[model samples]
Target: MGPTVTLLISIGLCLDWAVRAQQDPLPRPTLWAIPSPVVSKGADVILRCQGHLGSHRFQLWKDGELRDERNTSWQQAEFMLRNVDDWRYAVNYSCRSGQGPLWSELSEPLALVVTGAFPKPHISSSHYYSAITPGTTVTIWCYISPQGPSHHYSFALLEAKSLEPLQRQSPTGTPAAFSFPSVRAEDTGSYSCVYYRKTAPHMASWPSQTLELTVSGFLPRPTLWAQPGLVMTPGANITFWCSRPKMSSLGEVIFTLWKAGTQEPLQQQISAHLWTSFLLPPVRPENTGSYSCTYMVQTASARGSEHSEALELVVPGSLPKPSLSALPGLVVEPGMHVILQCRQPPKTFLNSLTFTLLKVGTPQPLQSQSPAGTSADFPLLSMRAQDAGNYSCVYHERMAPHQVSDASEVLEIWVTDALPKPSLIAWPGPDVASGANMTLLCQGPSWSTRFILHKEGSMDTPQDVSQFSLTHVTPKDSGNYSCRYQPGTNGSLWTQPSDPLKITVRASVPSNTLLITLSCVSFLLVCLLLLAIFCHRSICIAGALHRDNLKRFFCCPCLPQGVCLPHHAEAPRDEALYTEVAKERPSEPSVSNSKDPEGVTYAHLNLRTLNKRQADPKETPIEPTVYATVSLD
Candidate 1:
């Protein structure tokens, strides 16, 4: 073989290998729609084919047949389908990219759906009302006419205004249902449905009629209140007002009144205003019950608001009025306990009585009590100024066919220390002579209706006056005194007490002089008793007469007027004898044998002495017999 022949054979092989490399296939391209795969009738669409950077040609295929081919310098080619309509439904599209003789594999297929190929279908919701309540299950049904062919059909639920399909369903039957387990506020809008054949040429029916769905229970609750008060006497008319919020949307509404224990509405009213009133007939005993109200938006799909707070209507006065009283009086001090008692009338035949205590200005009962007896007591513990008010009570049967009694008479309760202290002054001085008249003046605020003079250690009583007089002041009247003022005639409240003033009563006689006079008289009587004992002893020493005859005697003592002394005489033997000797002084000098010339009464005694024989004669010349008399002048 020659060198030239071998070189030509190598060149021919190299050239053949290069030509084969240029014929090999490239990587697959990507195919997608510009807006979406689904389009309404007569809409334009763009099918884009994207491939490798150096690719020069792109071919679009519909149902495996070449529909269009494009020569482009860019990496992606867009095929614009102008006036795309319903006949183009169920179209499967793909694309491939080419570089000279080399070509890329086909892309994934896309199903393009066109709607409105046949007559419109009928669309409906499970809810019949114009408005739907939230949290409820809702189902929308799309179906062809009954006469239409029942075959494999698909449905699409679309938002009419947005032109967006929310869901799709393919069912074997003629009618298809789309379900929402729990509908919400955002689900409220216009909705429509359409059906298709679900086959190669997916011919679709026109959209159904637009159905409006609204949600309820989003408005605030209305306010219900009664006119002429919650509690009323028999035969009184009441008007209940049901009012919606001012900012709520304006619409026709139906207001319904409902009794607590009954399911049926008591009344219903329709109005366009925010508020409306329901006037009830004259009330009776059987009319006492709790009430509430609600309003509904008056539309094809009516929506209702929450019920208002309960309003209780009380019709009392069917029975005779009861008596009400305050125990331990109406006036009480703060922190003290008080009982407001309601009692049934005598000879009343009602049973199972329940009592309600009502304050004058309070809309509701202050308290309730059901006693075993006919009376009920409402105790106010730790009473304060806030507890003071005019109160009354009414009684009713505990069980149904509730019969009520008229309110008892109003009772007023007062709490002391609501006012300032008053000033108490004594006229003609706090200290006055006994039997003199004195007055205690109470000065307080000009608004005070009455004054109360309080004496220490005595029960205080309210008085209407500026001065309290003491007719005959005595030691018994002496005490600490104070005063307080009451602002109302019937009120129990009082002002704080004034500073206490002490009263002292002086007697007629000087105490010191009386004491001295009593002491002198006592001493004189004591001395007379001693003198009588001496006189009796002196007579016993004589021993001349018989014991019975030898008696000692003395005169009674001279005493001042209103004074008297006791005198008695008795004989004593060999002992100190006491006698009371009193000298009676004559008014003028007199000479009498029985009395001394000095006008002083004297006691005279004569003694007989016995001498002893010779032995003692020389010792003391036998002292002459001596006699002595004792006297107290």
Candidate 2:
């Protein structure tokens, strides 16, 4: 055969072998020590390897080199390691199974430890304190005094709970120190150390005494607050602030927001500052409940602070708003009982409803009530100034799926002493004549927007205004009047009563008769005075003139030249004088001598002396004159 054919034959055989190996794959075995892995000096131990039932041969390898081989028809094989007196007997040993030319995978390695060759070492932590805070650096040392002179030594740190070594190191001298940069709560446990020689007789010493470690208590509690307040509408977002006092350590802290009755947190955050914030999703009606927060130092430990004070969140549900009203009036004096009635709208179908009263700044409900009717009455007995505030109410079903209604319009309660006193006064005067118009002007504080005027004893309705006008006032209208005022139109408290003012109405008199009497008296006095003056003057003139000359002087020019004063002539002894003047015209015939004439004039004068004698020359004489007319035509 040529070389090409030989090579072809070899490739075919390899392919056949590969297919057979895949069809009959070997199983890996488990290895274990019959006695404990740690044996004292001069003790014997049996290392056992377990594999498939059909194993033909078992090979034991120590430290990656073949040590012994045994042919076995059973599923397991055991090898005896006798008199383990030196550290060289302590090494990694493994086994593999083989049938004919094929061998199985190697079993897991088993460690054989030799002890009691020397005294136990000493293990201790670097910290002098019993408990250590998380994130603090820690160190554990394993010390073994050397006998005679120092030799090459290696050490292993082991936890009491686990069989395997946690860490291994070669030390240049005694007392191997293992440094942990940062320790946590999970690092708290019992630990020990072992030392072994690094040369051919790698003998391990006995384990040192177990050292116990502990992590300290949790950090200080944090404070929590909400932004935009605790009460809010649905679909609004809110943020919670979790803060701690400025820490001396510059370590990261975790903030967690938690809801009540739940174990898991709603949100969590990590920040380096003294405070952190948590923004929540848009709220709904179901989100209205209590919440809290806590913080933990960001480390591998589970320790954290106590929860902060709980905060309540409110999200009012969708329902028709109720109406709120105060009985008697919105403005009332202190100590007066006021009823705030919250009423549902007409045709409300809900039954068994609960009504809650809420204030502006307070987070929780001030009071709650359940009523059978459509309205709930909250009676404020003995109201005080502290009870005054903006208030609202809401209603909800008492049963499952508790449906809540929207908040009612805010109603403010004013509790104070009645307003200030308002002054009341009559415009013209307190007294008025019958049938006279009178006005009562009422004045109050400058801030007062309303005033009320009332009568002392009358059934009339009180007037609500700044003033009252009363026309044609009668006795009935005359009464004591007072006034009160309110600060503003926003249902402010009413003021105390002002000082009362009395109104008087008097009867009037008739004026016509008095006017007539006065006129008559004045006319008579003027006539008497004029008569005395004329008579005195006439008498003075007569004393100086003759009787004939007096008649001529007094006669009318229209009379005849031969006419004489025969009708009235001389003066009487009592100093009374009379004179007559005829009325005749030149164009008419004379009728002076007739018994009845058309017209005649008469003059009478009377003069009186002071002592019935001649008057003094030094004083002027009084004139006495009187005139009268007589006519027959």
Candidate 3:
């Protein structure tokens, strides 16, 4: 009963435990879950088999007929109907699982409901109304039959033909609704919706009813028609018609005729489609422009269509009055130019124009057939007296078979010739000799002419001499004179005169001859004064020499009396003394001594007498000393 008994008991216990575990694996299937009641047709339906271990294989049946069987990898085996058909409506379906001896009882039957197809959505005619004019709201309804408590329905509005969804909403029951607050013409089209059951997986019902919607509102813009084309001449009557297809059947139409860009209608409130006629009776140049029309229905809302296309009115025949003016006024001088401008009123269609210049008081123009439009210039080349005249112009249009415009106002012109020669005449006749008073008269045929006079054989040029006169004339004043005449502008030419007239004037003595003689004497006196001034200058030079000698005499120092002596004959000693004396005495006179020294004096009466005595030895000897002096101190 030791190790052998213990090993046998352990093996038996392990085998028994294994047997019990196999007997108690998972519980076998007793029931299967069924799909919900009231499922929409054309939607998938599923059945589920649930049980314990060893229930891998299961079989599903519809009304006791085996529809499908499958071995399960899942805890519960599944049965599926791809899109339930009408034959599956309210049908009994069940499921069973497990092998021969261990097979489970059949599950309770499930009542499968296949709902009717979803009804197409519908919208009433009244559901399509406008927000403006015939202001109204639009309503649409989505309906599905045989409703279920667990079923949910949704409504949507889709664009016509495109099927593009516009809006969506959930409904509490089978029928759903959608509304538009303001309906418009654009809201007209097909609309649809769909429903589904919550109990069934992958079950969406078919589309509900589809409805066509038409929104009523104002008509689109009315088209316009006229009796003739837009451009018409004067006196042509035009009729305009306005109509719209939508509003054609409605009652009491009101039409209005209007010119483009103007709010006030030319005609209004006419009852017919061919509403009114615009009569351009005898239309003038001013009546041309663009025209249009509008149509309205006489309802409480008074809805109106947009205006029609424009029609242009034109006038062809009439031309406005033309006016002409010269740029610089009339009466132009020779060789000058003038501009003649022609013009018509504004907004007038002037295709062509012309201008002309005429002589005064003459119908025939001096210049004509000039180019057209507003202005032209009149050139008076080297104008003659005959070129002076009155000028006017005419204007016209260039349309085929040309039409002429009214004549312009007339303008006057005057032209004159160059200046003329003047005449010179001596008054008291040309026979008057020298020493006569005279006057010169310059005259021309017309007093309007200006006179100029010139003298012959003289350097002076001609000068303006309206009048000429002389108080007195001398022989030097004799000369021939000529004159030229310039006429003032009276549309006349200037003139030239004949050769100069000769006049003679002789010299006469004047009363101021004494004064002349006096002037001559005064001039001679002035000459003599100049000569005396020259001679006085020579005498002054001689006096200057004598004065110089006197100054030299006064300036000499006095000789001492003892040192000077006169020359004398004596013995040798005496002679020696005489030499001494001679040495002391000066040859020139002593300036200080008035008398000769005592016992040593010499005398002289005149230099000439002394010179004579010296020249002649026989002359008697004079006293040796004229006077003598004795020195005391």
By TM-score, the best candidate is 1
TM for every model, in the order presented, reads 0.35, 0.33, 0.21
Question: Using alpha carbons, what is the TM-score of model 3?
Answer: 0.21
lDDT of 1 by residue, 1-633 (tens): 999999998888777656855665478899887675566789888899999878889999999999999899998999998788648545788999987656778999876767777788988889989667788999988888888775767788877744457788877776888898987654666888877776767667778899777666555578998887877767888999999864323457898998866879999999988899999999897777678998877766566778898776667756899999887777777888989889999999777777888889877666777788989889989888888888998888766777788888888786664545788899899999999999999987554788888899998867888689988988988999998888753476667889999999987677799889989999998889888775554443321111233333333333232432221244344434334323432222222424433222232222222222322322332223332232211
Candidate 3 — which residues are off by over 4 angstroms?
1-122, 125-219, 248-250, 261-263, 269-286, 317-633
The TM-score measured for candidate 1 stands at 0.35
User: Residue 62 error for model 2, in Å?
Assistant: 79
All candidates: CA RMSD in angstroms? Answer: 37.8, 39.1, 43.7
lDDT of 2 by residue, 188-266 (tens): 6678777776654556787888877776775666888888766677888888899975443325778899986567889
Query: Per-residue alpha-carbon lDDT of model 3 for 1-633, expressed as tens digits?
Result: 899999998888877756655675434454333333434566665677786654677877777788888886655787777766655344667777764234555777764535454434433333434332334566676555444542354445544333334666666664556777775544544665444443323234444456656445644455665556433445766566655443223456677777654568877665644343444345433444456777776767576666776654433334554566664655457777666665565677555443434343542344544365565566656556665555555443433434444445566554534333455667788757666788777775443345556676665443345566656677777878766655554434445554678877766657699899999999999999998775554331100001111111111023334543332233122111111123222233322234423223332222345424332444433333122122211
Estimate candidate 3's alpha-carbon lDDT, on a 0 to 1 scale: 0.52
Runs off by more than 4 Å, candidate 1: 1-220, 233-237, 246-250, 259-264, 281-288, 299-306, 323-349, 352-354, 367-384, 398-402, 417-467, 470-633
